[model samples]
Target chain A: MGFFTKLLETSRVKSPWIVHFDCGSCNGCDIEILACLTPIYDVERFGILNIGNPKHADILIVSGTVNHRNAKVLRNVYDQMPEPRAVIAIGACGTSGGIFREAYNVVGGVDKVIPVDVYVPGCPAKPEAIIDGVVLALGKLKEQRTAKDTDSLAAELHQAREFYANRADRQVVE
Target chain B: MSTIIPFGPQHPVLPEPLHLKITLKDEIVTDAIPMLGYVHRGLETLVSIKDLDQMVQVVERVCGICSCIHAHTYCMCVEGILGIEIPKRAEFLRIIWSELHRMHSHLLWLGLLADAFGMESLFMHCWRIRERVMDVMEATAGNRVIISINKVGGVRRDLSPDQLRWIAQVLDELERELDAIKPVLTNDYTVKKRTVGVGVLTKEQAYELGAVGPTLRGSGVAQDVRMTGYGAYKFIDFEPVVEKDGDSYARTMVRFRELYQAIDIVRQLIRKLPDGELSVKVKAAKPEGEIVCRSEQPRGELLYYVKGNGSKFLERVRIRTPTFANVPPLLAMLPGIEMADVPVVALSIDPCISCTER
Candidate 1:
């Protein structure tokens, strides 16, 4: 790899901007995610910013259970992010739907729709655990960057697009 | 020509999924249609699956910010049906926890409002003070956000004498910190310029449209569900915090003052705490009547209608959240404001979309 390319990849790993999406959570995990940005937890000190746009984000932090209505939106957000991105599914709901799993509208966990690299477990995962999950996802992000060649990266992107395209119909069938 | 701009389902300003189709004429708004059901998880429908005793945990998840009040109101509804009067100590304990939840929730909203107006440092300070409340909750109730302390009869946990004293000390510290930030939130030129006279909800409009909580009180309505003296509110000495301006500034002042009011209420409950059993073991009597119970949440007045048919499961559990009642007022307030002020005005009601949708 070129020196500039290596530098960019290292920077992406060191300072990953995150976009947080609440898929049908009770707001427990959502508030905890916000708590991670406050002075006490201060995820920004590690160069992490909780940004709004998915395209500019290096990490996607999802909390809550996937439902039918928001599944398409979640997939759209994931597709918007660039390649070599990481996903951290926080809270019991995001990991495996938590208490709301049995609710009629719930579609289980975040992994049911999009690929997730880290699973942080708690009914509402603690801010500390969410921070840890983000750190773990960063390692996976670096691994994905090192492992994929340009050709392989293009192939993976195409596969992800196809998978997401078919996912809506698959959800309907289920 | 009017333009329809879709706001949210995913927006940085909103914490929950609340979409609004805002119709604007030039720079001013003409109409707004709210699109909900994004955060709906069919929680009320869980009444058929989970038994009445198990339903406490279910209802508590309705809104994470005001989880205790939801559980408390649910228990009160069931206790009314079964005619089981909880012990005095339990009532006081419930009051303490509920007040703490109120304090934390208002703090969270203050931080969000500051962030909405681009006062990033002010937002940080608001949240920094809120962490102490969260710490107190964690120390007393074992969880930070969703502290499930209420059961069917009374609270599941009791405060020891040492913990109570420690909480008192913490409240003193919280009051000092809140005082330090009070001037910036209330008297700051930027905050006033953005909030005062913006999204004015008149007294008649607020009352006729059924605005509740700070939204109602901010419009000079002295109505509060706490005045009904449910639980230990009868024993406590406090009045509803009211403002007369009926604008975003008024609403912000209502919640800001409420933070201090909640701290005061908690202190009173601690001082006048009556000694008794925490709860009474409920007899296995299926609730066979339909009843409605109401409680004051941090957002507004929350109503729960429960119907039982002499079975292990409730026939129906309908929740009328404060946000649902406040939405109409919010819609009414939107038409006259500029597009830039939409978020601040919408946030002034402290809309909890998850609670509304659930």
Candidate 2:
């Protein structure tokens, strides 16, 4: 278990491939994240790559507030990513709900549906903060190196969905 | 019958909310149905309750990348209805920012397109050059990308000689970097193979489907609303970009060529910019009428229709973004293409789902 945990942690720091998903973000944070990947910041230098295929990714960085219509789609995508993965929720919208928290369309925080490794808070967080959040997420990822042994992350995700489902107040999303 | 594939309000390839239900048989798409309104914040309902001035902020927020284009179109519609003449200097500045935005937007799309094709170097190089443009936007305006410099009558800010000089220097440097990439994009066998014959739209098809921007231009039609000579376009001596064949390659080349034209337009605006106040005081009177405004955004033709009552609130507002028009042609093109080429073809029209949904 110790050795397996180290393998996941080592991969988390080396080449952390990220797949970005927007639940209901205002695009401000999404663009900022893109800026970090651009030339000046070039997070790619740190082996951070924005990948398309979920099967190959190690990190799932979600931006925006997860809304009603997209709740299922978001879960499906998170499931498609290979085992030994981490979820990093970026922007205030993802963590709490930002300005749209009270809105009818929003599905509360992302943690309600998926287990989040780290939370990056900002109205629309700066690119530098995003870089730092990924680093922080990597740290959390390393700590859970033996992710396959107990499968705590998967269980956490199931509990999260159940939490949202059990809420009687919400009408739109299950 | 062809095979069917779903592209998305939740696609891995696109950043926007677009659900393209593509029907394909043996690598050809037989039919397509576009699913929209995912990002709809009920903005039109929101507009019905908000004043025209506040609507500008909301409309600008519709699409972060093309925020200025929406503001310009909305303001022009308002100005047209009131019969207000803007300052020449403000007009020039508007064109300068608009074109600079066009450059960065096209470059950003280019980078995404490169990434779609798995060309990491091309993606890196294009994004590297785009940062220079973003720096200029940040230096001039407080924000880097969403430079909220547009106002109702004219503009909200002015440029100093030092700033103008700095803008010119950076613009030239970007122009040089873009020039270096031009030949490679045009001549690269990989790019040509992936895009050249992929999404073909004929001239009549372009007009019939109401394709705007480079998607329209790539079809060999010279129909740029900028030639309508709105703002400073009338003052500057620039020709519209047109390419024949209407393939994905043609659209790609047209954007590459326009980067050069945008730089030239900015240089001319700087050299011949007039002297005057940046903006005039709006009367703040209630707008009570209907107005329609259109512009050539980086994507294509954007249409905005606004209805106002005698109160501060607008009666109704409607927006038809370019991607709406480009989708039909995309459906038409998707059939007969391999699955591997899906990402490039999907991105070819530069999907802006936030704008489309809002």
Candidate 3:
């Protein structure tokens, strides 16, 4: 790999900019996620910045459950982010839909619509846990960037395609 | 020429998902229509599956910022239907937790409002003070945001004397820190410039529009549901914070002043906390009637309606949150404002879309 490419890979882990999207959260996880940016947790000390633009983000941190209306928006956001991006599913709602799973308009977890690299599980998911989840996601992001060979890229595409195909079949059956 | 612009489903200033279809005529807002359902988890409909006791946890998730109040109001509704009175100590404890929640929520709003106006340092300072409240919550209730302590007959947890003393110490520090930032919030030139006279809602307009909480109180109306003497509010001296200007500044001041008021209420509740059981053992008597319960959340008045049919599961559970009432006033405040000031005016209502949609 070129020296410039190696520097880019190292910087992705060194300072990962994250964009948070609230799919259908109770605001508990959303606030906790916000708390990570505050003085107490201070996730920025790790060079992590929470920006709003998905295109400028290296990690997509999503909270709450994925509902019907926001599912499309969530996919749109994920699609907008440049490649080698990582997604962290936050809280009980984002990981497995928590208590609101039985609701009619609910679409369960974030993985129902897009891929997730790390899962942070808590009713609200404390700020510490959220920070840890983001850190873990950065590692996955580094691995993703490194494993960009043709064979690995093709494998990831096939896995993602199969995952969506199975989801479509499940939806049809349901 | 007029053009309609969609102002979010994902905006940096908004902490929750709220979309406003704003119509602009030469940089001035002519009209604004709100679009919701982005965060609707259909929590109210879960009454069919979860039992009455189990519903408390579900109700708490309606809005994470005001989770305790939602659960407290729901429990109050169920208790009213069942004709069960909670213990005095539990009532006081509930008051303490509710006020703590209020303080943190207001601080969170202040930070968000500051962030909205691009005052990043003030935003950080507000949240810095707020961490003390979250720590107290974690130390006492075992959770930061959603401290699920409320139950049907009473509360699930109890506060020890030492814990009470620690909370008092934190409140003292909180007040000191609040005073430090008081001038910047109330008298700072930039804050007033952005907020003052930006979104003026008349007293009549606020009342007629059914605006509740700070939105209504900010408009010179002294209508607070807490005055009806629900929970331990009757046992303690309390007054609603009001501002007459009815602008974004007025609403901001109302919430800002409420932080001090909440600290005072918590102090009073701690002093008068009665020694009794945390919760009563509720019998197998199922609630068999419809009842409405109301409480003052940080945003404003929260109302819960519960119906029971002599079964484990409730017949229906409905919640009318303060944000739901504040939206019309928000729409009213949006017209005639500059496009640049939309974030400040929109955030003044402290819109909780999850609660509004749920």
Q: Which candidate is the best by DockQ?
A: 1
DockQ winner between 2 and 3, please give it.
3
TM-score of chain A of 2: 0.79
Query: Per-prediction TM-score, chain A only?
Result: 0.86, 0.79, 0.84
Docking class of 1: acceptable
lDDT of 3 by residue, B142-163 (tens): 9999999998889999999999
Cα lDDT tens digits for candidate 2, B1-358: 4445666666665665567766656566556677665665545566655577877766776677777788888888777766778888888888888887898889989988988887878888998898888778778876765677888888888888999999999987997898798888978998888898887888998888877889889999898888888778888898989999898889998998888988999999999998988887788757778888778889988998877777777788789888877777777767667777777887888878767766
| lDDT digits (tens) for residues A1-174 of candidate 3 | 699988988888999999999999989999898888988889999999999998799999999999999998799788777778999999999999999999998999999999889999999998889888988998899788755677755676676577556743112111
Q: Which candidate ranks first by TM-score, i.e. highest?
A: 1
Ranking by lDDT: 1, 3, 2
Task: Give fnat of each prediction, in order.
Answer: 0.57, 0.13, 0.67
Q: Which pairs, if any, clash in model 1?
A: none
- The regions of model 3 sitting more than 4 angstroms off are A147-174
